[model samples]
Target: MTTYKESGVDIAAGEEAVKKIKNDVKKTFNKNVLLDIGGFGGAFNFPVNEYKKPILVSSVDGVGTKLKIAFLSNVHDTIGQCLVNHCTNDILVLGAKPLFFLDYFATDQLKTDVFQSVVKGLTKACIENDCALIGGETAEMPGFYKKDEYDISGTVVGVLDKKNLLSNRQVQKGDILIGLESTGLHTNGYSLARNVLLNKFKIDDYIEDLGCTVAESLLAIHKSYLQPLLPIINNENLHALSHVTGGGIIANTLRVIDKKNEIFIDWDSWERPPIFKLIQDIGNVPEYDMRESMNLGIGMIMIVDSNNLSFFENHLNSVNQSYKIIGNIK
Candidate 1:
């Protein structure tokens, strides 16, 4: 008779991993989370009476190839934050506030400490955004994943009043495009980035241009615009929002605009961040590829009525948020 452990599934280790992370995960709960970890299902109370017409907006996303940087750098913590924040921004573009989040973590071997660190990152972001980490699944499969490597994906659920739902219909001609600066290459373009950078430089190599090591630049946490944009999200002058992710600035911004209207982006509006320039010069990457793949410095785009330009600019300035008038809807 073959034991489960003999088959490479250590039930005891799995139990131990859950025990370590139990308390950390609980920190993200508010009054709404009904059940805790290790349950058949996590239950969250929906505050139905909070809105006149509540709309449930949900998005599921993974960290993508950016995880490769985490694996190479031996940093497991920030990757979880990347997944949570990425999902938060996805629903945020629709003008929703996160209610709860669920994560899926899978690995070939169970490393209790690494697992705990990842959950800590998740709980940190969830707490920051007032989102609950209701539940998640952790799997240990011996032959499935590569050695000492894991993958994570998360699903975020948020709510918005129907009246606050932002759509392309709200975007109009003469709408000004305001771009929020990105921290770095936030959770996208790693396939090309790694190919170019890693070939010529070690992960820890310091470059004067970047002012940091390759690991530092590549593993920068993805920014969550929730707190910064929440104040003006419902304003009448704020027409639409685009979260720059897998698609670069142009494609992602175009996603939230009307098909009948086209966006004019001044490519020279903002200087490309150093990490991007390094990738281009070393690899001799074409400008079109750079524009198509990376955020190229701008992370979030807001299309606001030109008449209210001063209002939007003032609000952002008051909050100490930097922005650029990259273009307008034509």
Candidate 2:
């Protein structure tokens, strides 16, 4: 008898995986989540009364090829955090606070321990961002994925007061750009990074320049800018915000600025993080590709009026957040 397990899909293992993650997933819930995990769809009771005019903002993102590093290093927990944080930062640039998150995790075969670890990371980040993990889907497809490999993607739905909505229309010339430091690559450019670095090094290999193992540097959790910027998002001087992701600085930052104004970046204003440097030198990757592909160092850019430079700088310092005055609008 060719059973489901023999054919590669394990119904039993899937059930076991769900059993392991149930409690941890519940920890991310708030009063807003009206439905449980096994339901057909997640039920969120939107807090329509919170804002005079409440707007729902949502974004979906995955960790990309960075998962290859997780597979190689046998570290799975941080990948979940990276996914949630990346999505959080996406909507955050537009001045939204996450309300709930739903995840899609798919694998060839479900391993209970790995499943548990991934959910634990997810719940941890959801709690940290004051978001609820109301529901998620775990698919076990035996032939679809390679051995021991899985892919994760998440959708974050958030709320913003219509009065506080931010956009390029608010940006103007002479806006100074303040760049916030990144933890690492932060879920981008891994395709180029791996193609270049892996030829010369293994995941566990420690490099002096990176000051850590290859996996350690690459798997650094994508930082969430919500905490620091949330308190000051509506400030008059803070004209616009940009989350630097797949397209690097120019592509991402430009999206949040006025078309009439052009951004001028002082490349030398800040030091390039070491991991980026290693990738460039080792891969002989061109300067243009580096700038277009990776964050290099800065992960978020704040466009604000020059008059309030001191105010912004002092505020960041108070929070112990490092920043660089990288450029201005022309």
Candidate 3:
């Protein structure tokens, strides 16, 4: 008799993998989570009383080829955290707080330990961001993926009062552009990085400037801004926000700028992190192309009133966040 296991899809392994992560996943739940793991669908109750006009904000993203680094280094946890945080910041730019998150994990064969590690990373971020890790799908397909390789993607849902939505109309000429420092590359540019850096050094090679192995620097978790910015979301001078992602600083910031206004960024304002510097030096990547690709050290950008600079300064300091007054819109 032929069984699914014989076809390379092990049903028992999948069940065991879920069983391992069940407890870790539960820890991320709040009162709003209506259902637990192993259900067909995840349930979350919206706190309607919290907002007079609640608007749902959402984003779907994956960690991209950054997983190549994970696959190379055999470090899976950080990439999962990167996915969660990346999704969090997407809706966060619009003044929303995370409601819940769901993830998709696919692999050629079921690896229980690695799956549990990834789930732990996901639950860790969910707990930190106050988002529910309600449910997710894990696919074990044979011959579809390369041996020992897995892919993960996520969808985040968040809610904020409709009146509190950040918009371009709030952005104006003379608005100060403040940039929040990124934690390394933050899940983008790895394809270029692997092509450039991997060719020059092994994943375990330690560069003096980085003070860590190439893998360590490349695996930095994507930073989430929800906590630091939440306190000032309603500030009148808080014009708009730009979550710097795949397109780098200028392109992402331009998404929220008014047509009548243009931003001037002082590239020299903040120092680029060593990983980026190493990539540039090795690849001789052009300025425009680099900005179009990597975050270049700044992950989140804001257009706020120059008059409220002190207000921002206090909040950033209170949160122990690093920032730079990189430019202005004019």
Candidate 4:
């Protein structure tokens, strides 16, 4: 007979971690979560009455090498938030309202306290978005990861009315492209960042330009666009939306554009954040590669009717949110 412990995966430790996080996760629960945490599968009680034709939207994502920054800084908490928000925003671009989230954590060893901190971040994000923490998996695989290293991924389920679903098919020529400013790197291009910065300067070394340690700048939490986009999603003038991620602004924005219409971005329209400038200056990374690899400063892009441009600008300004008219479709 094969034993789980002999296979290098400790079922007992995984169980203990679950037991520790069950109550804390429950704090993010809403009426939609019908099942408890330890079940064979998660159960979410969909609000059938809430929609005439409810369509479920789901997305899964990982923190990528941003996890390395978390491990290096000994800050495991916010990575969970990053995972949840990233997944949530992925579906939000389709005009979905998040319902619940599930997470998967895998590591070579189990550290209960560190895992708890990660769960706390997830819980906090779920509460802020009014979503539930339904269920998740915690795996301990001794050979699969380094002793102190772990990775986190999450799945978010959301709802949209069949009539309200947003797709790239709606994108058209003459639509205006608006960009929401990012709060630093927002969880991509870390491998390149680490390769350049770690070779030249220690994490503790303060740069006068950045006014802080390089590690602090690299570890900034990925910002969520849900709050700012929510108010305008129902507006018919909104043509298409894109959430800038690993492929940077061009690739991500193009994903939601119809092939017939080309997107023209004015590179000089927005201010590039200092962290990106630091990486570019030190690494001598080319401008084209920089545009293809990192967000540069814009984390999300909205494709809206030119007629609605003023309305969008007013709403963003009312929230004290900074944005730029990066380009338009032609």
State in Å the error of residue 100, model 3: 0.6
**Ten consecutive residues with minimal summed lDDT in candidate 1?**
163-172
Backbone clashes per model, in order? 0, 0, 0, 0
Model 4: per-residue Cα lDDT at residue 211: 82
Give residue 169's lDDT in candidate 2 (0 to 100): 36
- Which 10-residue window of candidate 2 scores lowest in summed lDDT? 163-172
lDDT of 1 by residue, 1-330 (tens): 999899878989999999899899899999999998898889999999899999999999998888888888888889888889999999999999999999999999989988998999999999989999999999999999998899999999999999999873478999999999988999899999999999999999998999999999998889998998999889988999999888798899888987899989998989889999999999999999998899988989999999999999999999888789999999
> Candidate 1 overall Cα lDDT vs. reference?
0.91
List model 4 lDDT by residue over 113-153, tens digit each. 99999999999889888889998888887888997899889
- Supply candidate 1's per-residue lDDT for 117: 88
Stretches of model 4 off by over 4 angstroms after superposition: 1-8
Count clashing residue pairs in model 1. Answer: 0
What tens digits encode model 2's per-residue C-alpha lDDT throughout 148-237?
999999999998888888863378788899999999899999999999999999999999988899999999999988888888888878
Residue pairs with clashing backbones, model 2: none
Question: Which model is ahead, 2 or 4, in terms of lDDT?
Answer: 2
User: Candidate 4: TM-score?
Assistant: 0.95
lDDT, candidate 2, equals: 0.91
